[model samples]
Target: MNQPASAIEILDTTLRDGEQTHGVSFSPAEKTNIGKALLERVRVDRIEVASARVSRGEIEAVSGIIDWARGAGLADRVEVLGFVDHGKSVDWILKSGGRVINLLAKGSEKHCRHQLGKTLGEHLNDLRANIELAREKGLAVNLYLEDWSNGYRDSRGFVYRLMDGLADTGVGHFMLPDTLGVMTPEQVTAAMTDMIRRFPHLKFDFHPHNDYGLATANVIAAVQAGAAAVHCTINCLGERAGNASLAEVAVNLRDQLGLNPRIDETHLVQVGELVEHFSGKRTAHNAPIVGEDVFTQTAGIHADGDHKASLYHTRLSPERFARSRRYALGKLAGKASLLKNLERLDISLSEENQHKVLQRVIELGDSKKAITSDDLPFIIAEVLEGKDYTHVELLSCTVTSSLDLQSTASIRVRLQDEVLTAAGSGNGGFDAFTGALAKILKKKGLALPRLVDFEVRIPKGGRSDALTECIITWACETGEVRTRGVHYNQVFAAINATLRVLNLQIQGSLQQSRSIDPTA
Candidate 1:
């Protein structure tokens, strides 16, 4: 039989430590937004937002967060990192309207000797004085033993002296950070166990960085060894390799350690994306829980297995993270993959037609191109219209554009066994092509749809002849339609996309004409 799950408090430091990441400084507005999302939406236990006395902008960001947190009655959950400068950091935090100070103390002897040039007694005295000032000023305190891993490893006596000196300071939590991210899981577990056993009356929060890529694993070991809380950041934003990812830590704590962390897992991706945008860092597509492609399965066997009683499913389903599972369409896709995509679009096809469409999809996938769901309708039309719809066809086209000159196009097209050619000049190549096509269509008493948007993407390692995909969105009388086309030249890609749209309209017109009653 399984045991009842343990509970762990989540302290998020995306703003404090995360801001330490190279070239990342969240604006006051961005920090406030992320802080709100972290507390109100994702509902972590606490959030450490910024360091004390960084700048006026830092003060404003922390003050704004305080305003928001106060209105939501969660002011105590907001925290800030502070220095042990004999109440200098405490005064700065108070000016920012912050209620909690995570006071940073030297956890290693080297930090004390080399950096502060203070003996153990002198450092402990300064730390106590700072804590006393914060307490007298009516601010809650949480002391951070920065580099606690090294302290415990090299000089446990110094660590013990610091803890013992502050034992009765009425601190809310004692945060132990593997500050340099240099602790193994076993070392973390052992250290946490020893600390919890020695200071059984105090609360402990384990903070881990990802320099070793073991922060998540080590955090779990700490929690399992009886730490009351664990600290993390959104999207693993921090100095160097970053901190343990909040999403990964939360989910793993729940599933691996059977520890019920206080986090709204569904909003994990929302926070991840919001942080990425503000920090100007792109999250990897394969990043667990919050990545774009984590939920996409691209194997034929996997899709088929899923269809056959969901054999490939797991507890980490996309729905658990407020996302849906996707069966990728490519050369590795099976008929089941096609069916899954078609089902999403609510379109059904006969078995014979399905086979033909799948073959075409495979051929297109072999070209090292991405096929989006929006491309499905165009593919369906082309495969079914094979050698049948002579409504419109581009027989030939020539376009030229030069600097400081009018761009020109000449095109020959066939409409229902009648061939016509036209020439036109415009501002650019695609515009010229459109102008020629418009004139030719006007002669046939046909009107084109309104082009609302045009997007283009070229794969990396580009050359003049590299394949480019053009996606065009049109607003027609009935509804909006999207089409895509790939070509070695960009203007030609747009032209091919335009041709697909024309063919679709012609087919629609033909269908409507046939639907009318002959007697009427």
Candidate 2:
């Protein structure tokens, strides 16, 4: 595709339309934080903060954002949604310190007659009155033609009449919303092209919904058809399915359509995380750009292909989004995938050992078991030795805890003929166990990596004693390592994984330093 000379403007509505997702709400501080992130970090051109007169809390939320935007010299770039309520919404907007208002007006004849119970002339007069009132209040107005796509299709005369009436209103922009998300990309392209040609001087913004999973596609189509700006929500959050996903749209424009998008691509995942934290709406693992599995290569053939050449990948590079590519070992994992895993652990395996280990990995995967890099050492020992390997072993462990009592742990570890014991107390039994291990490593002048992440997953609808899988990611000076443990007890699995991570860090660091400096 031929690249465009300039990037399109991105107006993020995560704080407004995104909040409309069922059971999602952001507190004032969260709203302010997200506003800052979207503007400064994500580098979006503008943001729609909230709707006017929604609630006292919403009023305060917009106020907080306005105050912050003013200090950051971004007040002019911030916007709020308002209704044509004869100065009611304008008054709330002014009091909240918002300078721009996205005025919502009836677009289609059906909405005018059925929803507002007004004739075409009456609806135009009411909108004109509201626009005049807002102008008098010193507020910039951008008009939202709610259901505009439907208006263009089913009621072209009514839509053209409304636009002709507003031609002299000095509105900043005309926002066309596919409110029902019913338009295909072809429809969007044709409608947008016609509107831009009909109203050559009017700036157009395209807002798309995701009910049919084509919001991103429709957004690209509109941009191609001459939209000056595109509206998106972080994490694709909105009513019903969602709005166009900001991350997905931005990436698509840059890579697929060859349109320059002025976005800080590295901050894409961070924006998704902030939105997820505030909105409490989780992003699915397979969601386009910011999803957990989007960058993870799951099939072994794909992993091998990636290793040889990145032919299996799309233009969406994980590194551009502040994420690393990951290869998931499963029933489909091949030799290339196992080699990559071994390389991360600084372990070398013969071709014979590699084939044997690959067979076992596939068997475990076929049985629905997940394997991590940390499990490879034990697997190697078991498969290679054909018997239990006694290189390092846990001799004994004792844990004690009670309500309102300090938790304590004592552990004995054996390395061949040498045995070491350590004891400690902590806020919880698992913490106590980790504390004891930390003390033992300290005695050996070893520094363990800090545990940066911990997650526990228990199958749904399982019994109380159902197996729990604990995954932990530890960050050391060298790099990050992940380990997994499974047991019926969640606490036990976490503790076990923590211990293994610490041990691996200590041994790996010691070996590296020794190789570098023989005197040590």
Candidate 3:
């Protein structure tokens, strides 16, 4: 293998090729904003904003991008895809104020024979004419050997003939594309080495697709094989499985190949978000570098290892991308996981309270699936205030509600020594549950206190299955008392809060009776 270059130029084609993604079309304004962010913030070396003669909107978009790029002294860095229709594509690009055109030509004999029905010599003549026209119009040219991977493999002579025909056309870069994403790393290494060795004076850029999920790997192979630059798209947006992800390509080029790319690490996720929003396509949560959960530790053992010795840490730290590490709270949570989150929130808990809180987290996780650090305070508050009382136990309860119909509830509860069943109807599920509890209390010559206030909340950015926290305040004869509960179901959260109140009220009444008469 040939030695890698010191640096590589990244040409982000998200706006042009990425728009080919299914159901994705960016408005001119959206394209302008993304182009600005990619060049100004993310600092990519080049951007391909549109294809020549696609639409009036594309012309407007390219004009906007080119205008801004020129003012920023980066006009030549912005490119537009152009076809080989003599001077038509060159004129379209000129009308859009574009200074660079990536001229597309067939690389394979099959494509030239079947798609265009022209010989390689005829195709070369058309390409030379287009290149001459572009140069005359003061536009730099880059030729895309479309499907060069298959071309090199099947008909090396056709590829050599095409190259020999245009070797002196003054095309700045010959971009080689794995258009169908069929080449393995070994194949890429061999072909890129051959292309570089044969055409030692020419610069090459590798454009890869992800149909086989090897775009990033193939990029490594190409870069190591002495390619000068590479082509990629943001969030891997493109036709079919999409192009190589810009984030993965940039990072791997730097870390795996020891080459520098003009990319601001912090702004990677920022641009990824911009494309993800404009394209209306959601990236995978586990996508490298820019994924939502890439930096999160869900395993208790991993958190523990990191806390003790940074054992589970890697160079791919979240801080590198302007994100923080989070220790997930769930059934897998251990004391170390709880401690890590507590330390993040700057909270100090005694060992006993910490144990209690950890247990509550595990119990809640059984239904909530995952709990974020934002939910930690709720669990702490609930566990700290709850008493170890066996005065009342909720055995089984069922609450049902329907549209335009009164809700109904049936409950079996054990109060001190008696197990009683009661049924009631009310306005909603929680209201019906309270009505049933009230019936059982009425039989014991007791009444529930007046409800002063009730509040419910979930963690920030919480999913639908996140834990629900319910806090209820009741007014008794003495004063107001508050109780809190955490559960996956809002109704059950309220019921748990109510049970705490009942336990407190029963304890208070018993204490008063003992004070009034020693042996009644």
lDDT agreement of model 3 with the native: 0.89
Tell me how far the alpha carbon of residue 228 in candidate 1 is from the true structure, in angstroms, after superposition: 1.1
Candidate 1 lDDT (Cα, whole model)? 0.89
Q: For candidate 2, lDDT tens digit of each residue in 23-129?
A: 99899999999999989999899999999999999999999999999999999899999997889999999999999999998878899999999998999999899
lDDT of each: 0.89, 0.87, 0.89
Which residue pairs in candidate 2 collide? none
TM-scores for all predictions: 0.81, 0.87, 0.75
- Ten-residue stretch with the least lDDT total in model 2: 385-394
- Assess candidate 3 and give its TM-score to the true structure: 0.75
lDDT by residue for model 3 over 1-520, one digit each (tens)? 5444556789999999999999999999999999999999988999998989999888999999889999999899999999988689899999888899999999999999999999988999999999998999899999999989999999999999899999999999999999999999999999999999999999999999999999999998988888888899999999899999999998897777777777889999988988888897988889999998898888889999988998988878888889888888998888889999999867799999999999999998988644767557657767986735557799999999999999999999999999999999999989999999999999998778999889798988999999898988899887777787778999999999898778767866886798799785
Once fitted onto the true fold, the runs of candidate 3 whose alpha carbons sit more than 4 angstroms away are 1-5, 387-520
Residue-level lDDT of model 1, residues 29-145, one tens digit each, is 999999999999999999999999899899999999999999999999999999987788999999988999999999888889998999999998888888998999989999999
For candidate 2, the TM-score is 0.87
> Residue 79 in candidate 2 has what lDDT?
98
Which numbered prediction scores highest in TM-score against the true structure?
2
